[model samples]
Target chain A: MAVDEVKLLGFWGSPFALRVEWALRLKGIEYEYVEEDLSNKSLMLLQYNPWYKKVPVLVHNGKPIVESLVIIEYIDETWKNHPLLPEDPFERATSRFWAKFVDDKFVPLIIKMSSSTREQKDKVAEEAREILKTLESCLNLNKPFYGGKIIGFMDIAVAWIGIWAPMLEKIIDVKLLNEEYMPLLNTWFSDVLEVLVIKECVPPLDELLAHYKDYYDRFMATKA
Target chain B: MAVDEVKLLGFWGSPFALRVEWALRLKGIEYEYVEEDLSNKSLMLLQYNPWYKKVPVLVHNGKPIVESLVIIEYIDETWKNHPLLPEDPFERATSRFWAKFVDDKFVPLIIKMSSSTREQKDKVAEEAREILKTLESCLNLNKPFYGGKIIGFMDIAVAWIGIWAPMLEKIIDVKLLNEEYMPLLNTWFSDVLEVLVIKECVPPLDELLAHYKDYYDRFMATKA
Candidate 1:
């Protein structure tokens, strides 16, 4: 049998790229990671993901898979040892539903917050809080993670909220995941951050904060 | 074992609902279809899917699954007779990628065209055509369907385009999925419409067209 050749093309600051990284690490898969310069992307990145031409492209045995969530699903299917999605079909469907919700609804609001202007910031934060509240309702304080007991697919899908939401809150001076409003989500965040695999893959807090701050400043400067 | 109980909550005009109906029919699964009144939704619809409170919701043996694509997946996984998604892991990933593309990118533009102002109609049509062109490039003339010979997941996800795009074109006095610009996609649309199960599930053309025309008139009246 041929050796499994796995490669991930990613950008350091992107939460989406980090998702693929966390999934790989949680599965204890060995692979090469290539950091792409977003300003001037590598030809390989372009060739691998022509549709999006974006990061978190996974190459396995010379076949390229794009879309972060799709890549994660492929990984879970290929590797049986550490199952990311649930065994039962209905549970798997529920997992995919929330994961899509996070991607389609939650993440976009967070991204909107990052680029929002002085006038737009408060409105965006208010909207983010509303979404956070919806997410809060779904989580159980008794369950340590979205996967109930283990750090599973939903954990990886949503881990960025714990890391990036705080960074945005600090930069914009608005609260999103307030303990008063979203206690379960706040606890979930704290617990997810403590997972060793997740912690190992997260960019250092200080570095991530600085990066976000710089990004916000540059974006605001252009607007001004 | 007890007999399996399956139910689908759907709205007749919805392409998303039709996708679920097509999947169940293709798999030869017996299901009770409940038509949802979007204006005043049923209690069961609300209870089953409080998150969106929208169709199509698939209930199998007392468990409800929301999101059209996710529901289709659940159906495919539970019933083993006919496989909607390919067996190869990479092919499955590719199928998912295109399905997401159709949902995320393509569907929105078509929906936009529906409510677009007289002024916004041309630009939205232009944008829809641009997306259609990209979809065109991915399709091969040699293959009869998005899944090559068989109508599969991608086919179901995109079936709405063949049905709704032309309706929008007729209503708006603009053309999308034009034969000259997107030959393969146009051909693919023609071939998919001929499929037996798909033919069975599609809403009657006259009724669907009248519904869309009425919808467009009401929307325009509100704007005016």
Candidate 2:
């Protein structure tokens, strides 16, 4: 049998890339991580993911798999131990649905919040709060994680909320995940952050804040 | 063991709904189809999918699974026969990546073309054509389907381009899928339409045309 060679092409500050890193760590898979410069992308990064030309591409052996959620699923399926997703088909579907919701609905709101002007920030934060409420309703307060006691797919998918949400709140001067309104989600946010795998993979807070601050400054400059 | 009870709540004009219908048909699964009125949604639809309140909700044994792609995956996993996804892990990821591309990138462009103004129509069509070229490059001219020889996940996910692209071109008065520019994709479109299950489930052309025409008129009126 051939040795399994796994390589991940990622950008340091990307939440999407961090999801892959967390999944790999949770599964205990040893792999190489190549950080790509988004400003001037590496040739291999472009070649591996020509379609999106984006990071979080997992190259196993010689073949490359793009898309973070897809790569996580790939890793889960390839390695049976420490399953990121549930075994039941229905539970798996639910996991996938929530993951999609995070990427499609929730993540975009955060990005919008990041780029919004002073006038637009309040409305964006309000809209984000509404989404957070919906997310809060779905959580099982009894369970420590979304996958019921284990840190699984949903935990990894929503890891951004744990790591980035607080930073975003500080950056935009808005409170989106108040415990009074979203108790379950607020608890889940804190619980997720404490997970050793997640804690280790999170980018340094000051560095991440600096990165987003720079991003915000650039956006404001463009608007001005 | 109790017999499987599958129910799909869908809207006829929605390509998202149509994908689910095609998947169930291809799997040879017995399912009850409930048509949703988007104007006044059913209580059951709202209760089942409170977050999105959209169609293509698959209720299996009373458990509702929203999101067409997620539902299709659930169906594929539950039923053993006529696999929609590839068996190999890498191949499954590839199928998923393309399915997502169809929804995320290609479908949105088509929807934009539908709602665009006369001035915006040509530019949207041009953009749609560029996407078609990328899709075309991925097809194997020798293979009949994106899954190769069989209508699988990718085919069902992209069924809209086969069924709706022609209508969209007529509706918008712009050419998007020229055989000269994208021979393989154009051929795949025809081939996918010819599949017995897909051909049977496609919405009546005259009705579909009227539906979209009314939609276009409403948008234009709003703009005016």
Determine the backbone clash count of candidate 2: 0
- Provide the lowest-lDDT 10-residue window in model 1 chain A: A110-119
TM-score of each: 0.94, 0.97
Task: Give lDDT per model, in order.
Answer: 0.88, 0.88
**How many angstroms is residue B211 displaced in model 1 relative to the true structure, after the best TM-score fit?**
1.1
Q: DockQ for each candidate?
A: 0.90, 0.94
**lDDT of each residue in A121-148, candidate 1, tens digit only:** 7888897788778877778677888787
Candidate 1 residue lDDT tens string, B81-131: 789998888989988998898888877877787777777888888988988
> Which residue segments of model 1 deviate by more than 4 Å?
A115-120, A140-142, B115-120, B140-142
Question: iRMS for all predictions?
Answer: 0.5, 0.5
Clashing pairs in 2: none
